[model samples]
Target: MERPELPLAQLHAFVVLAEELHFGRAATHLGIAQPPLSQQIRRLETKVGHALFSREPGRVTLTSAGRELLPAARQALTGLADGLAAAREAGSGRAGRLRIGFAASLALTVLPGLLRTFRERFPAVRLDIQEMTTTPQLAALRERTIDIGLLREPPAHDTDLAFETVLTEPFVAVLPTTHPLAAQRVVRVEQLADSPFVLLPRAVGPPLYDRITSLCTGAGFTPRVTQHAVEWQTVCALVETGLGVSLAPASIRRIRLKGVAFRRIAPDTARTRVAAAWREKDPSPLIPHLLAALDHDPSDGPRG
Candidate 1:
């Protein structure tokens, strides 16, 4: 059954009159004349289908029905006020969940600070971070499964998505501590051309994978691939076991696994770039707070 829409004005008048037990004073409290207040009480009784007041020789009091409804009527007004407040919060983007997608490389360095600042600035906003590769991050953004993505540069096929570069750092040579080249303070790209390489699969992020391979080609030889891995950490793990030397973003240096040594390339050949991306048309108010929290004049920091 449909609930009746209670008369809000009548409820206000009835409650005041019940407290004062005098029509004139109740009307004064309500900022109205006594006749109008009295009429509202009569109207309220009609809606409730019960006589809500009793009069006896200059004495006024609530009948049994009015006493029963007094508490419930106040509760209804309180609920209405609360519901309106909740709706306002939702509309203002001051409260809501933001699903953020990020590259695994960020976990060791940038991700922690980004998260910490975001929490401090917007304590009420919720965050759900997903570790995804650049390719998958782009897909998730398009599919709307994730609200925003922080990863490598996306494919240049769409103009509707906005990509903002946040960090750009040089790639470093990752080698097992036992490697002969580990003796050198700086390893040239050409120096590692002969060593079998541990490579991240192209599927993980073709642009980054291709860039790594091209660094070897630029040094006058194609890299000899001895192992294929998915995550950059996995590539580093294989290099740690002496499978081969791998090249990775400088940020990977922050991931300290035993038996791994990071070496710089002469003049810093290929740079790893990090960017935050979202649809150009996305109008989430949460975006401003996020961008503000992460805001900084990015120095040429050596990280992924």
Candidate 2:
């Protein structure tokens, strides 16, 4: 037997009429005239192949089939409403995860405050963070492994990616508190030229590392790199243990590592630039919101 597929409008009319049981009341509840409300009930009965209402003199009651249909109609409407809400949330980027790739050097200097702000504004977004270098992060972005990257300066020209500067802090010398140069409020790069330098390998990022080396060379000395660490924190850790002095962004001062002193370098020797990059024309809605969060000053910390 071919049964008529139920329509939501008719089911709604059936439910409202069933609950009220009076044509006048049901019509008012549905914001319709009594004649139309009664006609809709008749249409629903015809479609269901069952007389849903027992018409009597001055009163009405539900039949067996109508009673059974009531709960199913309400449950279906509730499910539909919940489904629409979930769809809206996902479309607005309020639900779903964002994969972020960042250079290890920035993990301590710039990432914490940036992430805290992003979370406060979009609590439902899941942040999947990965520690990667500038060069690799480029490949990650191209390969679609990560949605955004926090990295040092990229090549001068690239059409496949877009980057925005997040922080451009001058280089600061991280020295052991006991080091003679640490006694000064600010020390020039030339002063540390003769000292054993602790630095991350140039492979980590040629732009920043080259800037550091070029400064030493311009200061008339080739830095004797005595130690190499993958992250800025590790360099400070090495400095704390009296291993060797290292150059880092001024933001590294916030680390407050015991036994390490951070001092500003000479004017214009080297600088550390941090930028957030993503696919040039990404379709994902999460990128813009993430970029806005990254645009703030980390020194200010998360907004109120």
Candidate 3:
């Protein structure tokens, strides 16, 4: 036998009527006239090929078949309602997990404040943060392992990645307090050209390491690099021990090493451009929320 298609609206009406157990009240609850509500339930029962109710003209009673199907019908309606609500929330960007990658330096400079603000505004959002080097950060972004990255600059190879400048930090020279140059208020990059330095690993990013070396070259000599560290803290520790002088972003000032003094470099030969990066093709709902939290001003030029 060919079965008739069930009407979803009529099924809803039948469930409401079954719960109410009164024709006139169920009609009111459905926001319709009693006759139409009764007609819809009759149509639903016909589709089901069974009597669903015992009608006493004034009172309604669910039949054995209606009782058997009622729970399933209610469960379906509940599931549908929950799904719609979730869709609405997601459409508005009100809920979801955001995986963010950041360099160790930003963890000291801007990340703390940004996260505090983000948490206060969107408490329901789950933020997963990972510390990664600039090179690994771009790779993670490209592989979709991270939704966004707080990095010094966008990768040169990943043209598909978009970058928004968050902060332009000037370079500062770090020296041990007892070092001879530490007494000077401002030291030129050329003045430090002859001094031994602890430098970032060349593999961290060629352009970045080159930028530091280029600044020393512009000052009329090549840098005397002594040690290559993967992270800024390691370089800072080396400087504190009087092993070598090093140049770092202004955010490094926040690190309070007892023997280290952070001084502004004269002529300002180098600066770090911190930017928020993400794949251009990826469409994550958390993008706007994270971008808003960054509060980056497009007009802020690179630090001199």
lDDT (CA) for every model shown? Answer: 0.83, 0.82, 0.83
Error of 3 at 268 (Å): 1.6
TM-score of 1: 0.81
List of clashing residue pairs for candidate 3:
none
Model 1: CA > 4 A from native: 5-76, 296-304
218-304: candidate 1 lDDT, tens digit per residue: 889999898998788888889999999988888899777889999999758568788888888865668767766667423224434
TM-score of 3: 0.80
Candidate with the larger TM-score of 2 and 3: 3
Considering TM-score, where higher is better, how would the candidates rank from best to worst?
Answer: 1, 3, 2
TM-scores for every candidate against the unseen true structure: 0.81, 0.70, 0.80
Q: Could you tell me which 10 consecutive residues in candidate 3 have the lowest summed lDDT? A: 295-304
Candidate 3 structure quality by residue, lDDT tens digits, 61-98 = 89999998799788878888988987777667777778
